[model samples]
Target chain A: MSDVLAIAEHRRGELRDVSLEMVTAGRDLADQTGGDLHLAVISGDVDDYATQVNREGVDAIHTVEYGEEFNHDVYTQAIEQLYADLDPQYLLAPNSVNGMDYAPAVAEGLSLPLVTDAVDLEEDGGLTVTREQYGGKVETTIDVEEDHAAVTIRPAEWAQAEGDGDADIEAFDADIDESEIQSTVTGFEEVAGGDVDISEADFLISIGRGIDEEENITLIEALVEATDATLSSSRPIVDNGWLPANRQVGQSGKVVTPDVYIAIGISGAVQHVAGMKGADTIVAINTDPNAPIWDLADYGIEDDLFEVVPALIEEFGGDVPDV
Target chain B: MKILVTVKEVAEVEDEFEISGGDIAEQYLEYDLNEWDDYAVEEAVQISEAEDDVEVVTATIGPERAEETIRMALAKGADRAVRVWDDDIESAGKLDVETKAELLAGVVEEEDPDLVLTGVQAGDESNGATGVTLAEKIGFEWAAVVNQLDLDIEGGVANVHRELEGGVEELTEVESPAVLTIQSGINEPRYASLRGIRQAQSKPLDVKSLDDVGLSADDLESSLAQTDMYEPESEGDATVWSGDAEETAGQLAEFLRDKGVVEG
Candidate 1:
């Protein structure tokens, strides 16, 4: 049996949901390799989090404490020291801003294959990972050709495990220097009203450049309001000053896996498509029938979104319950 | 403030890529500088030409042919060039993006650039993880999809505008020795002039290898998961119901429900 290390993600003592997703991914991989799943919580005063993350499937917990919070250098050095101490066949990290900093550094330092933005995991004798590319227009399966691999699971793609089971917790120490931690995180200013992590959203209505005029966005919002769904979009729409980048879904944007994804007037470019194809059900409303979005969409409408969206708003607004 | 721009020679996006046997077929494809990296080159050259104390260095990884990508950079206006040789490493997509990022890190660490500019994402593979990854390796602040950058080097800080969905955030302060992954529309990439191209070959083009950088060969290899790369399935021909915008809209709605992208 091999061993797997699941890196815990946090901001200001609160654990991000993606950290749970990484643990879930770690468990899946551990099952595949017939190894023990070890969750590594790398934050200062991580004892509380260590006990909290201790679950049945987890074989052990490594709580590495250093600074009061995350500084990329400290975390990177911590992970580097951790891997050096307890080698794992696979290291699972949450694909977050934090992971973005340390994952590659760990891979580079260790000279290991580093796969970022993985969406799904299948446990075989060796794990096979699925990642969307060219902005979700294409899905590619990655098999770790090496004996050990490092992967950053895209947040919100995997389901977070929810249960009440206390497993053994181990407080592991990595002798890391404050000086070794090269970069200083001067501050952590949370995105106001941005606390809603899109990756965990089960329902989403994403717009694209095809939506064109921002005036029509209200009609789509009406449709969203009718469903009580979150409104997001592609990069172009964000680029046009139509939406916030936080709300963008695509390559170069946030990847989402909602239960229901509604695309209005989006052509489904590969870059834009990579972000949301993981949704359980996708519906696209656009005037262009040939829009690439229809390629994977379960339902596609070819019409002027101006009229169709308004009709959807009108029909669903009155009859649909606020979800 | 000198700018070090890193670019790579990649298959053009518009060209059809062959995904045979689960690996990208590199042969018979027209090779060009990566679309985003070219943008990095363009922005650097433009900034260097406009501002004093700004010299742009075009750096790349690959074989002799990679010089072409750097030559293009010089044509665009980089004052010098460096090619991380070892064609052996480039051929294998086996070189993890982080390994390449490390190489870039090595270059930047040596140069100690005031600003390290790169494309937010590349067209091919488009992993786009390198900038942030490299920034961390070298201990620099990184901002992705950065649309605007105003730097005060001696002040050791930069004001960068990052594009967000529907809105833009003006970040007033990020330290120097930072990495900015520029978006495509931020600046127009320039075409190299004939004179610039000729002079580029005469300019200094240094080549370094993994051995030269003090990294073991294993450092070039990846320990993390390897991608069994494959082209995405081609979307089947779309069903078209053409008519006026009104009629078409109705048909479209009907089709969407049938497809399950919308409520019936």
Candidate 2:
């Protein structure tokens, strides 16, 4: 009744960073509930992943060796069987792309109350999970009114667990039904490969939805030429086909560590920020003063990009294109 | 063959909005079709156009206001629409994944479509679990965060590209009668033309209650409750330049030169 079970995530035969972060989240919850923190690593080099994620404060590590990569069916079955055996008070999983794939199915199969993308979790009298909504404009706390529940922590929210620990590692035989497996992983592909890698840039001039029409993208291109900086954008630009996927920076895109990131007409959604927050100097040019980009910017200009961009281009002695 | 695409009318908060009673103030929120679901709707419409004898139906668990959004989908090209709502669902504030799955499962059973298409997540709550949860609830195969889908109707398999992190994509083959949560950028969604808008007015928009979908008030019960809602404290330490465009641009140019971002 007073135990926590956390599922670790890995991909392509390597452990993801979120696994260690979940360890930190699970250990905190275990301390609050006065319980032991147990971890389950399923699929693809399970023994190695289990040993790597065996951070301090973990009580036990359960290995369920399965397929090479993530198959939601396999994870769903393994986690369900593990849950029935352990009966932990709360189940923790990472809200990564793969986590979203299986966590919901597990919760539904087990008929437990589920919360996803939790940025904060606390246990006072009951479990309260804090999450961002309306695209990070506001925060809300949801109370789970059940003895047992499942939550998926947002990746990179908590610091990764450090140091080694002495924990018991055991192999859990997951009864996988071959007949029930409806999906098969055929192969993998690396996309967004092209002329330039945004991750290797020194300065990035990023654009977003605020650019509006597709024709207006040329205005930003002029800035890129004038400043000799690389051109990147938030998700919308790539989604609109105005830019290629390789030129996008975000969670599903590329993580960039530029010396300067000039975010023009881009509101810093959490997903977009995850890619470029490591910039040495951040500048935001947006019309809306309340845009979230200001939170991350070292210098902000609450003005329209249409007016400021041309002037900046002229200052850099670059040709300004007529839109 | 039929494809059921799930759509939602989500609220986008204004730049400056107020929070009241664990929710955003009604006046400050603008309702529109969710960004992700727009792509899902476009994918369904495109598939319907490409194949023969295919019907594209959309389902929504929203109130009367959402019909405007449903009509937008119809204008873009869904065959018809089914909306499930009642007093019980209206009062079910902040629905959890299980509750949403149960509600949508009833619709899935009634429709019995060959393929289910839904957005990766709604823009408002961003739960991102209802599609897959509903798939599990109805005992169907599913793939999440799918950016590319190639459906082979004769073979009864859909080859999909699930967008993973760090610019990697995992390819999978999902059995037909599967639920696919569509990601953005799969295809360019078409804008609703005036002719399409006029035609959508006469399209079949069916409204149903929980009983219509073989459910009851008990199914709306959820274990999760929103206890509090508020604006997150701003952590902005930005040095904002207060001036017109030219002055601010000059200040920015100077700063860039100082940081060696651009040569002076």
Candidate 3:
């Protein structure tokens, strides 16, 4: 039978949400192909992650205790060896920074076809994957010809796998050659100290390039103060040094699942959307009626921010600060 | 020191695209250099300008019109450009990531640069597999989605700060001869000046066919096929509010209060 292997990712000793999401994706693929779904965890302490990820639909959980933090050399070697032994027809990994770093090497080393950032996947006589283009303006379908393929699933694209499972855990030996590794992780550093963590904020009032100038950021800050919301921004605001990098929300920044996300003066680019699309309620305020942000927003207010912010402050029963 | 950067020509279609004969209509399409690669080109140029005897070369695989993209790179301070194309590659139809990576590897072998750089992903396919696959084929250490890069030319290693999920940043050191896929927002790209654009026309842009790269139709064969191209189904039926600012804000406040987003 053609079995499917999913590589689980964990960071800072906790299982990443994408780990469960990949298991769901792998399970669906395995069901379609009439094969078993196996999860491979390559971490120093695999039991904690394996115990947490041992969900329904997984046939077995394979553990390779290599290191505490993610190392490119260790992961690449482990995955390559595991693939050869498992002989899985479909291999899946999360399309995050860690997954992208090693998945390509694994695919290339094994000469397997790879498709990254797949939004939708299905099997209709052959494996068909759908991906976005031009900032989600177009969708393109790709059909993989090879029976064995590697795919990276974007986070939150698929529903997280649920239910408990009693899949047996097995110790896997990768026999990693330490001499082949040429890179080392020096350490992890926070982007900014004493900065507001926007990802953890329940209500975010984020601004973008439309803020006009650095001084205009005060308007968003006043709104945040009035509404008990946290101040965040798009990449332009962070790149311009108006806001700290930790406050930026987008693909290259933070993936936030805030309860209420108020996007102000932000034209929704796909990269930005990928980060905040999971919010429970989204409110967009922009001057352009045709802005893509409106497409995903639950409420759209098309107007100038200078006019809207004062009114919003007044409406929220807060004193309007002079511009 | 030599640096190689890869740029792509992508179609900029703001309007809804119409599929004509299983492909996007070419008439309404306007081509521009891939946005991500622009940052990569800028990074390479900045590095080259910082050091002595440093040369920056750019390569692309596309139709003859792709030369304009290469010229754009040259205008931004690339020393030279190379275009890899062949009739057989075109005749064989759609090129998957593997084929494209192999083609890029062919050019990398020819250049044999000290470091290679590419955009994290292209705008069209958005697969993000080319640079990594090329690194694998050429056996180079690699780091993807790099936002901050510091090169130690003498030590032959690169100290790169990679952006990860949840606003995490990882500092890693990779030995020289590595491939780095540059993420946007790394640095603001400089626009080509009038003089720069004029000078780009005379810069050397070498064109090579697949045969010259020692590849034939068989080698260029793609394992992936495009089944269809269509518009994504729009989600969310946004309720647009129109009125004077005060009235709109009052309405929004009322709506949010009704939804309990804001305390009354």
Candidate 4:
């Protein structure tokens, strides 16, 4: 039987949500291929993470104790060793920053075919993986000929694997060469003092490049004050030094699931949509009626945001915040 | 210091795409340099400019038309360009990630630069594996999705800040002879100046065949094939409000209140 191995990720001693999602994806692929699903967790205290990842569909949990935090070199080496020992037909990881960082190195070391950011997967004679291209505008199904493959599943694509399983926890030691690790994590620096987390906010008023000048940001702030909404922006606003990086909402920024998401002057690019698409209600204000954001928005106001925003502020309360 | 940058030309499909056979129709498609790669090229040029005796070279695997993309890199500040393509490589059709990585690895072997930089992923495929795979194939330390970078030529290390989910940034120090896949917003990519463009036309651009890289059709065989392509399903219809600013705002406020997004 073809066995599948899933790499579980943890941060700050807590299992990330994507880890369970990977288990779900692994279970489905294993069931399709008539194989067992094994999971690998590499961390300093493997026992802490093992129970969290021990789900019903999992057959075994393999632990590699390296360090508490994620070490790229250790992960690459551990996965390479684990793959050789497990000899799984498919190796799955999350299509996250951590997963994408080390999965390719493992794939290359093993000479295995790699398909990343797979949104969907099906196994017929071989594997057919679905991925989005051109910024999620089009979807393409890729067929892999290799029997053994390394794949990274996109986050939030699959439901988290639930139920309980009595999967046996095992420890595996990898031969990691200390000298080979040329990079070391210095520390994590919070981009904007970590003061504002837009992802947790209930209401958000987001700006984009269409805001034009930096001085105009005051108008959005006035609306935010009136609506009692948090202030966030697209990548351009952050990149332009108009706002702090932490206030950005997009793929590289924050994945926000607010109750009300008001997008101002933002042309919904796929990268930006991937972050805030989970919002309950979306309102878009832009001059361009054909903006992609309008498609995802529940309500669209086609007009100059400069003019429309002031009116919105007046409608909300007209209490402009000090510039 | 020597920097090698990888660039790709992607099809810019602005309108509704028609599918012929299993691929999108190319009649209405316009090709341009991948948007993300522009930031990569700009980062490489900026890094080279900060150091003395730094050489920035660009390489791409595409048809003759791809030279325009390579020229764009040179116009922005790269020293030279190399285009890797041949009849056999082209005839094989869409090569998978491994084949593309191998092809790029071949060029890296030839140049043997101190640093390799590429866009995080191509806009067309968006696989995001080529740079990391190339690093592994050529045995270089690497980092991916880097938004900030500082190179120490003497110490042979690069200090970088990588973007992560939830607005967290990871700081790492990687040794030189490394590969870095650049993320967008790393820098403001400069436009090609008229004089720079004219000079880029005269810059040294060399085209190499697969044979030159010691690769054959078999070596370039794809492990993954595109079986189908289609448009994503639309979610739902949006209510468009057409009116003056005050009227539209009032309507929007009313709708939000109805949806319980704002106070009544």
Candidate 5:
């Protein structure tokens, strides 16, 4: 079948927005290839999800159930069954922790060609996959040749799919031979303060290698507190152990799409840009006017972060919080 | 636990890249062990070094030139090394991450270590999917982008710390005999010292074909046929602004507000 198969991904009951984006990407590719569209959902409760993904122009929704929780073996087995059942020309999944887990295994298991982190797609089945090389400096594009390809899309790149078609939902029982299932999630670990993803932040004030010394972060921290912005940094800052990698914003770190992205003492590095470039508006404050950060910045302050930060704090009516 | 870490040999990131002849030139290219893969190997070594019960092993599937990659890892402290032994440049060039992952996965399935680790993503291919894929195929408990890992060999559990957006999520315990794809900065990878380099060449490595792992190249699908290679597009020079400190600050503020990114 020339139908484009799109997989829906969810966590903690919320359907990841990228799943919708995958539908958009899938639908576009389907249109380009003149193919039908099908969506697959694997979960303990596929009924609700089946209805959800159907709205995105899905002609049919295939649901497979397993444990109430996410088990890698269970999901991968479910996916393997779906691929065998549908035989769609292309399958799309988001390039995230979960997607990274399943897509490749499925690709490998079936001996299918897989191109991941695709930044763009072209008509006529030419998948222009944009991937970083050399620490995110260069993005290489490739045209894959496999007829049945599986791809994991990077988040925040594609526009979300929208439609009002709650099509037919069908329960799928791949009933994979349990012996083939390799891994099981014996448990799920929740981090200390609950799940707070930096990628989910609405406002972010990210620091970079341009900022000198650990103590200087208090200024940026002060600004963040003034505006309730999340505190984050680039790879170099984390590499130096000034901040934890969780707070890093770059290709090597979480991809952020905040309303306002403020960079202090950070010269824009490509690696860092990959994570935060999706912001609606970017603000870069560096003494170096020639910094690459300034190019993408909607607003640029070619001045010392030291002086500009405090004035913003004073004008914005706030002081640094005690950490 | 004799651990096996996989390293990739990719082109070096260049200062200035040119698009010549409609493709990237293979020569004058700089390559290193994929940074994330390096972390995976580094973490394995650190864990094994911590416990007396473990040994760190590394393997790579690339051309003869890839020997250097395995050697570099040895320099970083990997014990035994294997290169899946390739001399054909075109074959190596055509080998995709899926093929690499499948071969490594098959090999590991046979090696059967107590724990397996890989970088959550690679700097070169940047696919970030191979570890999970390999883990899935081999039937190992798989986790990705995990920032912290604590081995509980006594109970055969792995206490994993996963990084969410603004916070850290803890996976209290997962029964080991598991696969972990490490995110960058989980730990600082150790650089190989001169002493380690000399010892690496003497380490034991077994060379086998796809048959060794019960796999044939026929089992893999080459969907991502890299039709061509070329240097990436460049970011133009930045715009430099200069003036007095106070004056620049005022101009900057004005620019910010005017641009609507900041509201006065």
Candidate 6:
């Protein structure tokens, strides 16, 4: 049986939830392969992260106590060495932002085929990974041709592993190369603060790329004024400077759980959906009936947002602004 | 300073489309510069504009059809471009991260730019691994999902903000001669003006074959194969409000009020 080795991700002082989710994914793969599941937790309070991630199904936890924060060079070297030591058939890591930083490099260094953002994985004599393409419009299955491969799982796709288990916890000294450590994590900053915190709102009116031009935002503003709802938008609106960064709702922005999240023209990209999927009720307005937002929306209106938004404003006793 | 930005022409599917031959029907697919690459191009162009004697060059691994997209980058401010393509690449069929890294690494070896920038991922494939993989292949430092960049030419470093989940940005300092995969919304990409478009038509668009870039047909081999492709069955149970815009809006408003979110 080929063993499965997965990496645990930690940020600041906390072990991110994705690490536990990765354990579940790794356990599934190991079970299919009839191999042991080993975990590697590197950098940032390794002992605690190792102990925290020693959940059910994990057979061993390897802690590499290096620098205090994530340094890709150290991670790459540590993982490469760990792979040499263990020679596992499969390597799994989270597809989070930090995972994106190092997983590809690790795969490259190990001379393994790399598959990323895997939503589902299956092993039947061979490995088949299911992932989304074209902004989550379609799903595709990729067959890894090699005996050993590396994969990065999308966060939240797999359920987090629970229940404490007795797993072997040991520190593996990774040979950190000074020359390869070229990048340094200076610090972190929260850039999404402003007069409004969208996460705290109960009624929210969110817009997306379907709003078209910056000048057209006033129409939505009129609706927000009428309904007394906080105004927010998908990442594109904030990226286009049509709305403030504080009003952006997505994985890189705010996690909003409003009582009502009225998504106008938002196709609900996976990142955007991750933040607001917990809302009490969701409503989507878009002309494209195939938009992914409808999958999560409790109510949907497949019509032009321009006509419907103004109509929505009027219904709420608000005046529509002409652009 | 010279910057090499990797650009790709991505296929965006129409709202209602059919899948044929395990891929989106060609007729229903529209080609355009990848959204993330647009931002990368903008970041490179901005760096070139801010610095003296800095050249911004774009490199793409696509067929002749991608020249239109490369011209867009040139129109926006890239000095020139190099496109690596041949029958081998055309038939390679779904190049994996390693194969793509090998291809782009060939270009990086020839051009030898001090800095390399690419979109975090191609919109169509969305692998999000090419940049870092290429860095490993070519022995260059790299930072992924960079949303803000501050170049220290004298210090030989690139200070960047890596956008993380849940509204956090990790500030990092990367040693130069690095590849930075740019994220969208890092900067507002400007449209190509008429004058710029005219200039772009006359700009140098060097087309090369795999051998020209010091690569062979064997290097195009990928370790992954696509076995299936299809639209995921919708799990949505949304109550689609019918009638015209007004009627639908009325229904939505009523629903909101019934949920105690809005008032009459």
Binned by DockQ into CAPRI classes (incorrect, acceptable, medium, high), candidate 4 is medium
Candidate 5 chain B weakest ten by summed lDDT? B232-241
- Candidates 2 and 5 compared: the better one by DockQ is 2
- Candidate 1 lDDT for residue A27: 80
TM-score: model 1 vs. ground truth? 0.71
Docking level for model 6? high
- lDDT per residue, candidate 6, B99-122, as tens digits? 878888988899989999999999
lDDT of 1 by residue, B1-264 (tens): 778888888754222445666554557356778877877787787777777878888778878877777777887788898788675566544455777887887788778787888887666566767887787678676666666667766777766666433132334356777888777656656678889888887888889876665566666665444456554565645445456655555664555456554563
TM-score of chain B of 1: 0.82
Cα lDDT tens digits for candidate 2, B20-123: 87799999999999999999999999999999999999999899999999999999999899998999889877677787777788888988999999999999
* Clash counts for all predictions: 36, 0, 0, 0, 18, 0
Provide per-model DockQ scores.
0.25, 0.87, 0.57, 0.59, 0.36, 0.89
**How many angstroms is residue B153 displaced in model 1 relative to the true structure, after the best TM-score fit?**
1.9
- Candidate 2 falls in which docking quality class? high
* TM-score of predicted structure 4, chain A: 0.87
For model 3, residues B71-142, the per-residue Cα lDDT tens digits are: 989998999999988788768776788888888888988999999999988877677878888998998989
**Global lDDT of each model?**
0.70, 0.92, 0.86, 0.87, 0.71, 0.92
What would the TM-scores of all predictions be? Answer: 0.71, 0.99, 0.90, 0.91, 0.79, 0.99
lDDT (10s digit) by residue, model 3, range A120-204: 8897567898877666666788899978889998887888899998999999978989887878888887664465678788888
**Candidate 2, position A171, lDDT:** 100
- Name the top DockQ candidate: 6
Error of 5 at A210 (Å): 5.0
Shift in Å, residue A305, candidate 4: 5.4
- Residues A1-323, model 5: lDDT tens digits: 68888888876666777778887788888887788788888875678767767666667888887656555567777887787888888888877667776788777777777888776777564655565444444456677665677778877678887777766788888786676554444444433232456888877888886677778877787777766668888877886688765687875567799887878888676657778888987877777644567668876667777777776676657774432
Pairwise TM-score winner, candidates 3 and 6 = 6
**For model 3 chain B, the run of ten residues with the poorest summed lDDT:** B14-23
